[model samples]
Target: MNRYNLSKSTKTALFFLSLLPLQWGLMWWFNLHPDDLELYYSPFFEAISTLQLYSLAWLPFSIGDVFYLFLVIWLAVLIYRFIKFKRNRLNRFISFLGFCALFYTLFNVFWGFNYYRRPLNQQLQLSSDYSTEALVEFTCELIEVANASHLSIVENDTSAVNFNFSKSEMQNLVFEAYQEPSNFPNKLNYPTENIKSSLLSLPLSYAGFSGYLNPFTKEAQFNSLMPQYKWPTTMAHEVSHQLGFAKENEANFIAALVCINSKHKYLRYAGLTFALKYSLNDIYKRDPELFKVMLADVNEGIIKNYKTSRQFWEKYRGPSEVIMKQIYGNFLKANNQPKGIETYSYVTALLVNYHNTYQLF
Candidate 1:
């Protein structure tokens, strides 16, 4: 009897394929033991995050950005080989699948499992449901904070506040702001964590995304071209992702918490302003009359700031941007965000619940 040996490439492919089931099983087990996952598993991942940040977070540029550039070039090379070379087709396809599986596995290991952790409301022991009166009350409070902060910032000749802080400066500020437990808990603390301007900033601007975390590299990247009004809050939101708040709404909630707690006046304004926009929009969707009334109360400087932001985005609006948003929306849904992009607005409930209970305002 002759024994056939499995080729190394075939073995490699099998290893990657087996991880699919292993990952699914781990997810299943974690889901079954939610408390253990939240109490033990999630914190373990956060510690891994700290180790990763200590290793990679201090590079002058985003290591994740370089990795992405290399990935694109590699993908291009594979396509050229598949089309022009036309040899070892099965092996090439398997290699591609293997690469994808490896990336997915690393992503989950590094950051993705936090998706199944307990929701922020449950973790904080706050009420998840809010009365309409509470939402209105919180919105009113945010409006005041936004107005006050808007007035405090220095304005350029054009009447828009000059975004004076460099990206590095803002990143450092973020690191400092998050030191407080109110900003982010000690267990998830990553005081050295940082964000950078996205290497693909122009493309991200057109795609309508303000910022994102590179799960593979543990770096936060923000669109540098976005309006100044959004910079601090957007940066904080991405950092929230690094803190293991995987859900979009939870990240926004954490961002708001960090912002309101910040000593930086601009950050305070940016945070409340961002939250107010969502609260007002949500109210508008349900009651246009109330929305109009709420809008009337917003400070003139804030209104001007909003107009400037609106104008900044207006130039980028088109079919391509809309399509990009749809694709991203689907991606979020696939990752268990049932509301897709709308999940962002759901942060309002968290804001209202925290406000009603804690009276942070």
Candidate 2:
């Protein structure tokens, strides 16, 4: 026997430890060469999406939802095995670390590296800064559009809007939204029927999440518990992820673009409502009095819709949601997103800049 008889645990620990340098090297390279990555990596992501579609698209149910169920079970089994095994604590810990390393490696290879790509704003030349007055102006314009769209839906005294279109129709409509001339950097093979309602709708609702992109399966899964008005926009948001926008605010901004450009009134209303809420919230922080005035300007129908959404979600609030948010927020922070879940709010600046530039409203 050799003098240095390294055990399996020691080898595993050393191997994973060696991988850290490579990961850091990649982070350094990508962070410095994002523009170059944009030029080269777009096709890789498109291929990933197309491959996933061809494989999982035909399934009637969400592969991602099923995957999550399996993942939970697998993790539980791992924990049990670790506790029951007679191995030393250090060996057990090394095994856990090796599992994490493998997952991280797989994640980056599949889709997580998209996090290092150039941001959409830079590619589209959209500025992110605007004056408080400019934000107020955009909020006012959104209020007018939201009022008109809300009126079209309300028709009667009832607050609930009718959804006459099937899920397929809505999916097709969102697809058409991006088919027109747009600001996207590259021509994407627009995703078709790629979004699905999550099988875990009840748990997702309690977790206070509307939707998420499953990177492993390349599926856009949304919570089905929300109202129909939210369905179109949330689908658009998750599909934007499938289009390779990993950042939350960028996905939201792209979803707004897709929705507002659609010919359908419901899609237009959902997009406007999405942008208006962000703009109004930003204005509220800058000047609450102006926010109140603008809020008063919104139509009664829109106000009723907002209240309905609020009341619908309030029932699901609990400690589980708080814990979920904390875990997710930390996950985001560990990624390139410095603001974590708060990055969702950064879409307001994007909306304001876009409105000012295109006079879209």
> Which candidate should be chosen as best, given TM-score against the real structure?
1
CA lDDT of each candidate?
A: 0.79, 0.78
Tens-place lDDT digits, model 1, residues 124-209: 77876777787887888788777767767745322555567887788777777787666543334766867888998887878878
Residues 137-250 of candidate 2: C-alpha lDDT, one tens digit per residue: 778778888788777877753465666677667767777776745534454456566778789999999999988988888888878788777887888898888878888888
- After TM-score superposition, the amount by which residue 257's alpha carbon in candidate 2 deviates from its true location, in angstroms, is 1.2
Can you give the lDDT of residue 301 in candidate 1?
Answer: 69
RMSD to native, candidate 1: 2.7
Best by lDDT: 1
